[model samples]
Target: MKNSKGGIYKRFVKRPMDFILSLIAIIVLSPIFLIVALLVRTKLGSPVLFKQKRPGLNEEIFMMYKFRTMTDERDENGNLLPDSVRLTRFGKLLRSTSLDELPELLNIIKGDMSIVGPRPQLVRDMVFMNQKQRERHTVLPGLTGWAQVNGRNCVTWEEKLSYDIKYLSNITFLEDWKIIFMTVAKVFKRDGISTEGMDTAEDFGDYLLRIGQIDNRTYIKGLEKSKKIAN
Candidate 1:
C-alpha cells in the first residue's frame, strides 16, 4: 500500500509548489542574477552561461544551466585544459557562494527540474550507475538536494547515491523544506564546496574503475554508449 502522504505530495502538490517557489525565487533574486551575470561576463569573457546536457527524470536528457566559471584555454594539441586550470578565482567565489547555480531557476520554471530532489548528474555518469543507484532518477532532478546539503562534493559517490535514494524513499513537504533549509545553511557556511584537491566531484566512471567495481572493458563500453547517447 502507498503512503497517502507521499503519494499526495508527489503526484499533486510537488510540481505546483516547485513551479511557484522557483518563479518567486527568480523574481526575488533578479538583482543577484544580474550582478553574477555581469561578473561572469567580465571575468570569464563572452558566453556568461554554461550549458550542458544532464540526466533528469528517468534519465531523460535536458540542458542544465550555470554561470560560466571557467576559461576556454586549450593546450598545444588543442585539447581543453583541466578544470583546475580553467577555473578562476572569480569562478571559485561564484561556486562557493552557490551563485553559479542561479540560472537553474529557468529549468525549474520549465518543468525540467524541481527545487528539491536528487541533483541532476552528467549524462555520461549515468552509464556508471547501478540499478539501485539509477532509482535516483525516479523524480525530477533538483538544483539542491539531499546529498548536496549533506556533503555536496565532499562525500564519496556511494554515500551521495545513498542519500539520494533515501530522499526518493521519503518525499514530503516537511522533508523537502528541511532539505532546502539545510542547503541554505550549507551555502552560508561554504561547507563541502568541493573535495580537497578537486575542482568538482570525481567522475563516477573513474571512481567505479578505481575501485575495481567495473572492469576496463565495461568502463570503455559504458563510455562509448554514453557518448552515443550524449551525441
Candidate 2:
C-alpha cells in the first residue's frame, strides 16, 4: 500500500490513522447525515441511499454508496424516465451542495476508497478506456480527486484522464492536501458540477476516439451493427 509519501507509511500507523479519522468524522458529521437522510426519505419517497458498482483499486468492482438525490420515476411501460425529469429541485440542491456525496465517506472507512485519489468510473463506461488509461485503477478511488477539483464535468474525458495520469505520477502528501483544499473551495463555489446543458457529464466515446483508443469508422460500424441486431 502506497502512502501519501512515495514510501508506505507503517501499516501500524496508517490503518490506525484511517480508523481514528474516519471515526471522528462519522461522529462529528452524524447530524448532517441524519438531516440528509430525512430529507431524502421525505422528498424522494423510498430508497434514501443510492448505491452503484464502481471500480476500486485494481479495477475491482465494489458497491459505492451515496445519498439518494433522484427519484425512481418510471414511465407507463416500466422503463425509467430521463435523468432531467427524475431529478427534482431537491435532488439538484443535493448535487449542487455535494451533500449527495457524503455517504462515500463511509466507503473510506470501509477501506474501499481513499480520501484523495482519482475518482472512480463505472465499469460500463470503461469500454472507452484503453489498456493505458486503465492505470488509474492502480490506486484506490476517492471521494474527491485532482481532476474533479480541477474542472470535473466541465472538462472533456481526455483532459480528465490526463489529470488522473499526472496525479498517479506525482502522488505525494503535499499533492493530496492541495487537492483536498481545492476541493473545499470548488464545492463552496459550486464549480464544474455538471456539463453546460447536460444533466450529467457527456458520453466519453468521442473523447476515447480522439485519443486513438477507437477509430471513428470502426466505432460507427460497431454501433450500426449493434443497432441492427436490436432492430
Candidate 3:
C-alpha cells in the first residue's frame, strides 16, 4: 500500500486517529453544525449542505460536503449565473470563517478524508493533473492541507500541487498537528479565503486556460472527462 512511506504512524495509526478525532469533533461541534445548517437553509433556500464529487485517496471519487454558500440563481437562458452574482454576503461570511467546512468532519469519520493531507479537488481539476502530480492521491484528501495553509486559493495551481507532493513525501503525526495549528492560525487571520477580487476560487482547468497552459482542445477534453467522471 505505499503507506510504508509514512512509516507506522501513517500505516497503522492515521486512520484510527482520524476516526477518533472526527467523532469527537462532531460531538463537540454538533451545536455549531445545527446552527450553521439552519442558517444555510434559511438564507440559501434549500440543500443546506453542498455536496460535490471530489478525487480522494488513490484517485477514488467521493462526495465531499460543506455548507451551501451560493444561491442557485440562473439567467434567463436557464444557465447558472456567474459565481460573483450568486455568492451573497452571508455566503462570504461562512467561507471566511471556515464554518462552511464543518460538515467535512463527517467525511473524515466516514473515511473519505483525513484531518491533514492534500485537499480534495474537483474532478475537472484532477483531469488536468499528470500522473506524478496526481501522486498526492496516494494518501487521503483532507479538510485542511499544506497547500491550504500556505496560500490556499491565492496560490497558483502549479504551486498548490507542488505543496501537496511535498506534504505526502513525509506524513507524520507531528506534521499533521503542525498543519492543524497552522490552519487554525490561517483561519483566524482569514488569509487566502479567495483569490483577490474574485468571488470564487478559480478551478484548475480555468487557471490553466487563463495562463495558456492548455489550448481549447485540451480544455474541452478535460471538461468532457470531468463530466464523465461525475456521471
lDDT of 1 by residue, 1-231 (tens): 122335888989999999999999999999999988988888899899999999888777899999999999999999999989998999899999999999999999999999999999987789899888998888899989999988899999999999999998788999999999999999999999998888867899988998999999999999999988888
Order of candidate numbers by lDDT, starting with the best: 3, 1, 2
Q: List the residue pairs that clash in candidate 1.
A: none
lDDT of 3 by residue, 64-126 (tens): 999999999998999999999999999999999999999999999899999999999999999
Q: Between prediction 1 and prediction 2, which has the larger lDDT?
A: 1
Q: What is the C-alpha local distance difference test score of each model?
A: 0.90, 0.78, 0.92
- Candidate 3's C-alpha lDDT? 0.92
Models 1 onward score TM values of 0.95, 0.85, 0.97
After TM-score superposition, the amount by which residue 48's alpha carbon in candidate 3 deviates from its true location, in angstroms, is 0.7
After superposing all C-alphas onto the true structure, candidate 1 shows an RMSD in angstroms of 2.3
Off by over 4 Å in 2: 1-5, 9-17, 206-231
Superposition TM-score, candidate 3 onto the true structure:
0.97
